[model samples]
Target: MKVALIDYGSGNLRSAAKAIQRAADENALTLDLKVTARVEDVVAADAIVLPGVGAFADCYRGLSSLDGMIAALNDQVITKAKPFLGICVGMQLMASVGREHGEHPGLGWIDGAVELLTPSDPALKIPHMGWNQLNLLQPQHPVLAGIAPGAHAYFVHSYHMVPRDRAVVLAEADYGGPVLAAIGRDNMVGTQFHPEKSQATGLRLLANFLRWRP
Candidate 1:
């Protein structure tokens, strides 16, 4: 399988790549994994993985700056219905718009908006960092196959995706309130937590994603 780990000048590319490669190796799955900024690579890939870090506006800007990247992604992942996984801010980019720093347009793959984390408790931190338990909403989803409810995933972000349609949310984490941990519809899925940093649970999710046919 060909997996395009998109490089649009954001995300921990090396770590995400290493983790993905490790998952493929462990599963004995043959994969041509490419960490690429090239549009052609994304066009030819069997699956797409978008990993991003930093601010929403900046990440969107970086991705949009790449000539034909957005359109290619829309074609390959959206139109073609190829499997897609977006990490952290990459997941946030799936929303219709983002409100971090300023309002910016997103890929609109999912019906939602990216906004600052507003935990009900006044004492909780802005960047909800560290390990948090996942409350599986769609545990039957292929990408979440072996991942149990209450499984811990690593997170580090001040923003969260608020999907307009609640059914799109696959998993959630409680941080004074419900925070979106995962979202999906049809062939697309995204994780707000960094699966690469979640150790065993992370690897399992990645492997499930690799083996996922949907």
Candidate 2:
């Protein structure tokens, strides 16, 4: 299978690619992984993985700067129903709008908005870092197969996505309060946590994603 690891200059390209490659190797799955910025590569790929870090507006800007990338992504991932995985800010980009710097439009694949993490407790940090236990909302989801409800995943972010439709949320973590950990609909799934940095749990999820037919 051909997997396009999108490189729009905002994500941890090498680490994400390495983790995905490791997953494929461990599963004995033959995957043609391509770390690319080209729209043609994305169009030709069997699946797509979008990994991103930093601010929402900045990441969106970087991705939009790439000629025809947005359109191609829409066609391949949405129109054609290609399997897609978005990590961290890449997941936030799936929301309708982002309120990090200013109100910036997103891909709007999922009905939601990205907003700052305002934990109910005052002592909690803005950027929710480190490993947190995932509370699986949809444990039966294919990408989450073999991943237990309390499995720990690494996270580093100051904002969280609030999906208007609660059914899209697949998992959540508590950082003084409930914070979105995962979201999905149809062939698309996203994680606020960095699966590439989540060690064994991360690898398991990635391996599941690699074999996921949807």
The stretch of ten residues in a row with the least summed lDDT in candidate 1 is 140-149
Model 1 CA deviation exceeding 4 Å by range? none
lDDT score, candidate 2, position 156:
97
Per-model TM-score on C-alpha atoms: 0.99, 0.99
| Model 2 alpha-carbon drift over 4 Å, by segment | none
In model 1, what is the error at residue 212, expressed in angstroms? 1.2
Report backbone clashes per prediction.
Answer: 0, 0
- Candidate 1 residue lDDT tens string, 49-77: 99999999999999999999999999988
